[model samples]
Target: MTFTGRPIRIAGASGSASDRRHAIAEFARHYPTDPVDVIIADFMSEFNMATFAGRRMDQAGNAMPAYDLSFLEALEPALGDIAKHGIKVAVNAGVCDTKGLFDVVSRMVQAKGLDLKVAYVTGDEVLPAIQNALSGGQSDFRNIYTGEKLADWDFEPIYAQCYLGGLGIAAALAEGADIVLCGRVSDASPVIGAAYWYHGWQRSDLDKLANAFVAGHLIECSNYVCGGNYTGFKSLEHGGDGWANIGYPIAEISAEGDVVITKQAHSTGGAVTVDTCTSQLLYEIQGPWYYNSDVTAIIDGIHFEQRGVNRVAVRGVRSGPPPPTTKVGITARGGFQAEAWWFLTGLDIEDKARMLEAQIRRLLAPSAEQFTSLKFDLLGSNLPDAKTQNRATVPLRIVAQARDEEALGPRKFVKPISDNIMQGYPGATFHLDMRQGFPRAVFEYYVTLLPQSSVQHQVHLPWKPTARTQVIDISPPPQTKTYPSRQPSQAATHTDQAVDLAKDFGPTIRGPLGWIVHGRSGDKGADANCGLWVRHRDEYLWLRGLLSIDTAHKLLGDDALQQPQLAIERFELPGLQAVHFLFRNLLDRGVGVTTTVDFLGKNVAEYLRSRHVDLPVRFLNRGKL
Candidate 1:
């Protein structure tokens, strides 16, 4: 079967099973009535093994695919429909050794004698390779697991693949594979791959592929790019349709691989503009190098031109050198940790933070034996020297780590915070919420070279085993859990948490306080009292805020509350009275709003005045405006 349309678009499903199924169904409903060409499902994460194994075993008995096989299994039910329309399905599931995966695919294709071609893309694990490059053979880097040098083994990897680019997928498609499987490829690989295959671009066609990859990246996270995380974006004026059912992003790729990232034409949300597209481009793309199944593109020149409201044309990107080595995963025993948090509310946010810090330090003084390490973070209004003229809530998070299991157990280190809630600070209230502790495993990694000839690609057909048949499972590596080293103490009780002042204000307001308000608007509309602020220029800017239990409950409730407006109002302090009024209103707003306050101030007076109506307001003049 061959693709006959403009290009095959593969949409990513949410990590959740239900969400993925819904996404697939939605894709099917919107696309051609008949199967277009290929439908690929990607289910990647450490926790998916159990889910995949359980589902497959229930369906096909004990003969189960590898742990990474969930990607394929998810689309198995759709196979008949896809095949009926002469389309194929591809999936990236399970963890297998990289070399092993390539070998398995190569062997399968040759044995089956099917008219299929295969290729392997690499470069996901670059940390080890970077380490190897930085260290010149003298001092080998120790695995986080074994604590031993990594050069003791004879393992070689073909593809030092990072989150890959579209080139490899294009290579596979060009080679004429009915199906393609990849490891550690970028979320946009399939989409970019389809574009390259359709355009028949070469590996050196960096400009075209990079443009296509950017478009793919914009829509890769499914919801985030399509206004899910867009700041200042309000609901549609007509109905709740915009927020209720957000449309997924789509890309229109030309024959030259120039891409336009947009949403369905009839969708309720607005189009993708330069601002929206730039925001998506910067999302989660750590540093300069962006990797895919093949090729590393240097995001040096990201130029965006608005074609339409929801359509953006991205161009001018460069390519980089592939890493010389591959990353190896190694797991070993670590230690354990436990943590607890409390809420502090009322007008004395700065004093509350100081008292809590002293109290926690005193608590640790008596029996520091129980914990190897201790940390404290003043969340919300409890932050040091926060300014507000209202009742603010501060949250205190305390974390403790121990070498032995017994010392780190929940009852030993975690229970003390809960036990001393009423004893520590007068207004301190401790909730029953305690973070559970678990064993930590450290994985040490190394980078080594493998001749390109060692890596092979093949396709496997499902059939009954022959007398000489030997079945080998091909899946990605298992994910390991790491333990936290230092956990902080709770800064405040639930009642004293801070609110975000910037987000609560109107767009017309401008000041340091307005800056604070704007900052909180992006931080999930947390209470102003439950946040921290820093004074710069003539304005008091809200830096960060912590979530309060009550506020969390309300925001996450079934009924939709106007959180965005609240954020706007809190941050938009019109004047001294507005600041005072906002703070006083926080107290009247009850535990829900007051429980999320946190602050950071230059001194105690500034902090107190920001939260007290009766206090004298002394505005700081820092030259210029």
Candidate 2:
């Protein structure tokens, strides 16, 4: 094989199992003529794996491909097309069942009478290794979030897997495998691995691999790069409805490490623009250093350019050596938690909340004190003469969790309080269909690092008896300094002279910040990051001045709740005309423990952008949106 000047195209078929099965047809229809070299899908997340284990337990199933079949089902329509077009497929669809996934895919290919080579990369699972480590005193299995050792915990892990790098995937592809199935690898590894095979790039090619990593990162969420959850969705059409059947993203990485992001041909819905690319780029990111099992990609230097309509070139990505350890996702049972929401309408919302809480406490008097956690949230404020009925209605949500399943289970916990419904506060109503309100087991996620030497990466084919495993190289962890408490050191360089608050601008217009600025936010483990951007260059200066680190803190911070801006870090991307804010521990111990409706905090940016801010007439009139 010889290197080509043309870049190899990769079409992202789906983001998650939540994707519609018809998306496969969408990709198939376009891919026939366009001819992407490979198709990749990200079917699993941290939450997805635990959810899969629960589902498997519910079904009494003991097999692989148990985590999520939605991805495979989605691609069923395109399986023939994939084989016909000779399009390579790579996926992290395997959670605990790579063999099951591989069997199903191979059977499908055989049924079609297609000669496709199928293989799976394994050795990510370290359950036995974890036990050995614990026994041999090699690792502490300390929780990365809470810093608690797994040994002291009473719960046994339902699913434990360490994240793997792309090398195993690259190895399978290099061995001429048409499809490669992986379990618990990094989300971006599929694309990175495919690029590795096509370019024959070594694992140590940090800069080039970092470029591929960013490209993979950008497209891993599929339609996210195509404006599915973009903040500027409304403004993309400048206030008209243009979003419908949005196309998934397609990435091309040249042999020389050129990253171009685009979409399939003749797609009618969503768009791909610099703003959209920037929004997806910053999603689920912690800071400048984007660490992966393969490399530490420095995102600060990464830049983008809109090459043409729906095509953006990503470049200038720098990198450093990867950390010596791999992160292991240890999911164990955290007991049962259940929640119920009651609507308290009319006057005295706060009083009603208090009365309801008192009533519940009185009713659950015997069991309440025994609960590990009991909390109440009044969703709306008590105001005199509210303008709308929606505003007048406040949801009183009571959530309780317990280590004892029987104590918190349906009969013991839910019955006592649920039986006293009529005796509760007046005008109290409930959500009619609330199956989610029932007590269910909560899986706590404990992430910890395992030395790379502890993991064994290999490629296995059904026909081959000999598994091709990479030899291990040992080394002491590099003496690197990690500055956890250091805040970003950058100040506003330029301020507009004409935009004087009192002089040039006669009066300040009060409106939502979305009137001028656009943003995107997402949760990363327990923390969150929100990126704010502007279309007009003139608005950038004003936005930067208005949305300082202090302003971001003021918008997201709550002094009474004890959730302050103490851990918030702010960064700037002037080229994208965006400001990114990182909030540590923003979620109350993550989505599992958080009582808020937006548990993942995906809408945190919209929440902050909706806050009313004083905008100058100069900026507000620019959009007329």
Candidate 3:
């Protein structure tokens, strides 16, 4: 299965029929003499789904109708051109169900007797399965809502499937598929699978496969790796044409599976750098375990060295053992909740807001007679301790939660708040109308391992011009079921331990002036405001002193200074602090501060101002002293 010649190439067009046609025409015009093996067009986005569904509902009274056969009519001509060129065509941007599309294309192929083998990857449809598992399974998972779990509510998912990996592409290439259609496969899987087919690599060669996978991940998003998302990217001299003619990605892979991600040499304004490439590598990948259907890529290391202006040498990656279980996505019924806001005016706004909220709660008490569970909150006003003197217009928001649809239906619960607004409190204005709120639906996910024996690989040959239509159901390998040993009780104990550990740590030290500390869930990486803090120090001593000997050594290399004073003059403290404070404030407001600080000395200007409030005379000599 070794590919020789010039190498297998793929081009991508924008997701629409028209955009794809234009992009293909553009590609053809630019490479009048060169030929490619495959062309893929992607047109899937969240917004695309919403629009497609909306249109379908208007025309056919069902949103799913948009995915019908008529939708692909515009693409047939372009696909015909690809067949004529002896090239394969793929569509990476489309719906979740490949079977529906296959049925239509299969019928068309039978009628026309076209020499084309089509294959598609579909697994995002498994999200519902994952959701179900998260809700029903007895894994003692954290409640995304109240952050609590109960054994009585344990359940299991109806189905679970991994987002098909490069293996789909591999499967397509193996079966000699002329056109591969896929939904939500990792951006890099197509190229990686194609490379594997061309190189004839074995599954045991994990290291080489990982290198290829990493390369694909780096450039799969196209523009993000080609200066569009580069933080320091400078615009090219060629006006608007620089970004306008940006090309899709191409990877020159080797027999060992090492890849050089690049675009056509003659393509318009594009440059690949370490920053651009690395940013894409870190995009959606959660951690060391990069999951796919076929392989689990354990990214050991990533290094980018300049090969040329547009070429980067990606090397030094390692592989890890694949997961024992496959993850399932399931969607199920959770509960219901709603929020309503009101404007409160007059003196002692906080006090009046609290009193108004109490009145509404009394009115809703009658509805609770019908509902088993009901909860409410009054936002905007600080109630229970309403002694604050600073008075202003307050926006009061009331929210309620309930267990069942019948118990929490909007008609039964919402009108009570509106009915009581002006009866008990003066100057209380209700701004929003009470509308029925959608019931809260929880999506659960479960993880279970299937033995390696259950998965197998096979390839099909390309269709001949006069070949008869064939539908082969490739049997998957025998799946080995290995239930995780940890029970629901043990899992709950572990969660309790984690919560206790956090509480035991007490308050962390306040970040230096102009900086703050924060935490991210879901295994995301750490972020800090230290970069901004270093910029604000007037004496430059705080910034220089901030770095440990090891960090300074790594950052400065051989020129690492022995004394912090050496770099003092080189430091643009005021300018740096200004930028630092700007970002620090933004992050604080954007997310939230995790820890509180007694004093923020990182901003020298702010520190001096604070000192002026306490000791006016001493503030003038503070910097000099």
Candidate 4:
């Protein structure tokens, strides 16, 4: 392998399973005319794993591929452009069935008379290995978040997938695979693999590999780095229309380990400015030390600088050896869940909610104990002296989860609530739709780690001449590091920042925290992270002082305080003028089983930004956003 010297332009076409399907076609369509070397799509997440598990359970041993069909549909239209321009494509849309997807794509390519070679990487599925370990009395599969032993889990695991590094992907690409399909490689693995193959970087090139790792992460979510979920939405023009036309991101990574993040030239909306890039950098990250299967990135020193329109230079990324072990997600059938909603109108909303809860509890008395989880929530408070009917009503939500569908079906869940309407509070009304009351299967997602050596990473591709398939085993990294379980202490930095803010800054005005700061939040399994940053260095000081873990818990209200695993860890990134918080177990059993209204915790940062804060009068005088 040899270095190309020229930078590789890798486009991020898909973020998740639900991302818009037009991106692949659009990127491919613009191809030769406006060249992009490669296109990568990420279609798996913890939530996706749970979704696939439920679907697998419903299939009952049906001989169907577990892969997401959207990827195939998206690629079918782009095949011509891909072939014409010789565009390399890599995606993790294969889910649990890489070979299935590989065969499908190969047939499609052959039918189209296209010369594209199709290959796949496998060995991510490890349920059999996990079962073997458990049978041998191995206890290494403890939950990464709660530290719970797998032996204590209530339900048996149905699926397990270890996150693989980019080496297997790189090997297939190096073997001249035009399209590389994968099963549960790390979300950033495609980009890492692309850069690895493009730059011909050795595994020992830690800094270069780390740079690709960070670049992969920044662009992995497609339009996210292009201001899709931006907190500073007001800055983007055309409002909703602008958002609908948001562009996807691309990383121009050089052999020297430098990267420039940008968007498609013809993108109708969204900008790739420093703030937008910073927002993506801070999202879904646990701390300054960001870990990938291939490299450990020290992001605390990283900085983003806007160079031109829709272009941001990423600099100062440092790296160390990757962790000895990689993460694995274990999924199990959590059982059935159902929910019902009732509206309380006008006066006595709290009393009405309390009465409804009591009535439902009494109605379920015979079998209530069978439920693994049950909760009633008042969604909102009724306004006083309101003119509109909608403003004066609060919603009462009842959610129940049980091991058996019978316990959550119409008789036990919906009928109990439906039978209470006439005996309920004045103007008591349930939602017109009752379908949500029907029980649906739910899966629990548990995250753990396994030694890299345990992964049997392999690449399946055809050799020349005979054109027969060959299985190439990819070894784990030659060198690895075991990071300390404990993180770097924040005591000194917290004390210094707190003291600076305590000193006089004159009078203060209470206002939304968003007035001076921007934030982004996301989930990692059951944990949620909120990253807040300011436009200027001065305001960052105040933000660091004000957003202590206690203050965050208060701003988060009862949800933060109510969770049994309510622990928050804070970290600071002075280079980016950002302060981030990681709320453990806040999403509750991950996205699959979480009953939180926010679901993936995407709204946590916005909620924190909406909270009123004692803003320095001096800062407020400058501008009021």
Candidate 5:
């Protein structure tokens, strides 16, 4: 088929529902004409959804059920503008209740006296399916990390949400939905759904859908593709302006499966370049194959070129069939935790921490069993003849966890620390956050896949059947059929030939990797991936060798490298001159349960960037210092 169709401009307004008000207002200011066919707002993430589910459970009998007002608060002010411009909005801002949010929107818009078609895509809630599986021995539900059964847990489940695709959203838009509210679809699905509807593409049109899928990924995180979170962010125009006026991203997707990612025209402070787009594309991706509920996008075939000022054309796109299963996010109350911190100054920081832990151990001797976990981390250095106060003082952070509130509560956990006030180390003091010392609920997420056949999807056309509520049937796409994994130029096999250092480059200097390389990394549940790229093609060879598995293991430091569960896998994108590394179980029980300092794992790239490495002297002489 010849590629002939209108290009759809999809703009992402909000990264999360909490920032919708600002996102909407900023978009309204920047986009005076409101130049977009569909506005996508991503309001929910794995953390936020779990948080909402926990809140709803807590507010079971409250006078008014708990619903996040941030989304509506943001949308209320922009309703007039949206209705005036006739721009359709797709958002996953509904949290756990799309119906309730839509109901609120229905009333708000009606009061404003605007003619709009408000619809909601529902049926992502999979609690009943989980219950059914649990009732039948729970063998069906397995943890995505460890292949253990969910039935093994003794506690009850808080929430279970399955990831849905863009079909239902397309159906809603087909019926002329002015506002499409959704609970928990893929973050990129809103863009995907909008593109699908705009192009009137078929389910079997893999190439078109693949392009849309990649395009959605580009604009999914508003400012990331527009230089906000990019590693080489300083290269963008006004890169120092900060995020105060950071612009949202816009994707110009053509019918021929070509995408040019850009920012709002005349928007303040950002640039869409090949580097920025590449950075965003590598963010949060597991492998070359970027999988979604609707389709498994083959990102390995990606090709990019700067088409114009502030525009990057991404082409050579392809796709694989959608995965046979959809991932279901399962969350439950893990336990309660209480923590206290003490500062040690002048000297003997580690010594002071050890003494405090010993004192606490003696104090809790009677009820030691009451605590399931007690950890003390001595933060900062106790350098001899310290040059600054910051280096001389260290803080001791002690945390304790238990199965319930009573045992690991503030009264019980804090009493031991407080009792040793006089007997503790000299010049030791504590700055306490009253809430942190108190027992607080901790959530654990169990991510796993479920067959698409079990999902119940419906599109609620609120204006259908006499401007009344109407639910239309929407089915899942056919099972994904496997295809040959795309391997680009950089996939050349490793050569065993000895490196001729003199032939490659004359000499070398040691410096931070960030000087010659850029990187982006993120987490998916317990797993993490980071992509490192070099600007010059000649630098790619050196980087590939520098970041090999053995070198990476050494670079991760002794603690992370020696962990038994740590497994590393590398995929090379030769076309882009980048190496993507997958680190397993790096974030403990994911961000929600991890006790690590880098909880979300957003800083992995920065951590690697900080590592000092050798660079070619000649290359350094040619590039800016």
Candidate 6:
């Protein structure tokens, strides 16, 4: 039925597999006052997908699914509340085994004696097709970022999952399913599907679908749009929200496609302001265009309005038809990786690090040819003169990756390094845990695109007596346009000046750039996107002019310097007073196998902000962030 009442409120309870378990219970606790129509949890990611692939191999005949248990843990406690309130649930936690999860959830419902109609969407796993391609030696599957062909890949791909859209989800909900489980549906697909079902939206309603797409994208990360990863975190602390128990976000979408983002009314911590919304808006995005399986959202023109306490109205999102292709992730066993950290304390930190590295390399030189990669990172610098022991200490981390586990075993990799501790530099002590020196399997992810028609999207309605499953095909749009990797953004209304910001804003002070700027960063495969913005419109021109590709490279410091080819694409979003940069191949082979300490690149923006830059004294006079 078409929605004619109040907006459909969809609450996001979990962002990742490891998100706090109490969030769903929090929503249930506040259900009476802050009721929602549905709750959606997102659990799958490239990193976790790799984990599932590894588990599939390790637990070959295990009866239990290699699904993310965290989602089940978060949802089970709230099931009674959900059933009583008739609140629908959707989650993409069925990483590699949607059917297995569906069976588990069905049994749980039976045990609870609840009448919830559990449904699951599947067909995302397409490993057989990939296997066939491999058998035939087809090289059509090419990496989206590096253009590396599948045939040229060093490792043998054992698992492949294509991203599915929301049509399958909408079908299940429309068929009266109370709970929907999906495997590899786009992160925002649940929200989009719920909206589509609620409003009876058809594929012809491109604009409405686009609006739902944006709303889903916003709240899919749970509290991120509510200040979880906000750069203005201090504001949350001082503004009486205090951030300890940050509230999860809810998207209320109307039939007209307008969305109002809010949180549970009596929820503690975090506020829904324009800045917080903007932070999530700029996160993990590549350019002005946000591509999903169902629709391509044009977010460059999107704007946020603070509409009272803990409320933000999102507007101006446009959309085009879905692209012809959808993203496919292939996972293979990369190798084994092991790491060791040494504390370099007190005087001559650099000299000590050099000596330690020399010793380790000299010891490992016998079998160094067996190592696929080896690197040393000096994480921090010791303080000058007098300070506490912690202050005068920095970690010298050595990470080694190799195809052979024995190559990184204690006998070869660890014993040699650990044996040198006594003979190493003064005050040099290694971490006590010798197990870390043992190699762990690493999974590599290869991302590429497949035709939308190639995916077999299916919805399974288990409650149905007969003809329970329906095949839903999402056809590619008839007309599609290529979006530029980088788009020229609108210029600041206040200035056309090309001069340095110091001339316009006032005298400059050398300090952290974060004082006047706020940022949020995330990863897309191996690439990292750092989006930074300012609080005031007056600061937009200065920020846009100051943060260039060259500036980003310099600010990135050693990470950029170490890369063989440092590629960064900068784009502007003047409406939000933000500059976004996409660093290609920055995270190496994605988060799953990346040796970088940053992992998902969540702190790339923080790293950039920490770098010293000349900030206008006038801006700093307001306050340091």
Give the lDDT of residue 438 in candidate 1: 36
Per-residue alpha-carbon lDDT of candidate 6 for residues 1-625, written as tens digits (9 for 90 to 100): 6668789999998899879998777787678888988899999999889879888767767734579899888878988888888898989999998888888889988899998998898878988876666577653788988888888889888889998888888888888899999999998999999999998988878899888988998999998988898988888886755888888899999998999999877747898899999999898888888888888898878889889888899888988877777889999999999988899888888899899999999999987899998998999688887468898889998999999898898888888888888889998799998777899989999998776666677788867766634444444445555655344443332355455665677888798988889999999888999999998877777888888777788899988877876588777776788888889889888898898898989999998999898888877777878
Clashing pairs in 2: 64-97
lDDT assessment of candidate 1: 0.43
Alpha-carbon error at 376 in model 4, in Å?
Answer: 1.2
Residue lDDT tens for model 4, 1-625: 6557579999999999889998888998997556788899999988778778666555666744588889998999999999888899999998877787888888998999988988889999888878777778764588888988888877788888999988888888888988999989998889999999988889999899888999999999998899889987777776433765888888999998889998987755887889998998988988877787788898889898889888899988999998988888988988888999999899888888889888888997776888988989888688899999999988888899998998887888888889988788889799989998999888888888877887889998864445354778988888889987645535224554564555656677888998888999999888899999988777877778777777888899877768877888888888898888888888877888888777888999988888898889888777755
Overall lDDT per candidate, in order of appearance = 0.43, 0.75, 0.46, 0.85, 0.77, 0.85
Q: In candidate 1, which residue ranges exceed 4 Å CA deviation?
A: 1-5, 15-21, 33-182, 235-240, 264-271, 286-293, 320-334, 361-372, 382-392, 435-625
**What's each prediction's TM-score?**
0.56, 0.89, 0.55, 0.95, 0.91, 0.95
CA RMSD for every model? 14.6, 3.8, 13.5, 2.1, 3.5, 2.3
Model 3 clash tally? 36
Off by over 4 Å in 5: 1-5, 17-20, 29-34, 63-67, 133-139, 236-244, 345-348, 364-368, 379-394, 466-469, 482-493, 496-503, 622-625
**Candidate 5: RMSD over Cα atoms?**
3.5
TM-score for model 2? 0.89
Task: Give the per-residue lDDT of model 1 (tens digit) for 1-625.
Answer: 2334464544444432223345444444445532234444454422222223233324446444433433333443443334344343334432323334456655655665544444444444344453454366534644322244555533332213233444455555554555566655546666767676766665566566666666666766555556654432453323334566666666677766666666654444544665455545654342345544344455635556778666677676666433332223322122355566777776666677678777766765655576656667666553344465233566767756555677655455655555667666767776565544332311111222321222222223223155232222222212212212111212222233344444432232223332222111111111222222233323332222322233322433321152323321122111111111011112212211112223111111123323311111223232211
Cα deviation at 495, candidate 1, in Å, is 50
Residue 270 displacement (Å), model 2: 0.4
CA deviation > 4 Å runs, candidate 4: 1-5, 57-64, 137-139, 238-241, 382-387, 463-469, 489-498
Q: Is candidate 1 or candidate 2 better by TM-score?
A: 2
Error of 3 at 186 (Å): 4.9
| Pairs in steric clash, model 5 | 490-574
Give residue 556's lDDT in candidate 1 (0 to 100). 30
Question: Per-residue CA lDDT of candidate 2, range 331-416, in tens?
Answer: 67677788877888888777888988888888777877668888888764655687887767878788888876777766656666
TM-score of structure candidate 6: 0.95
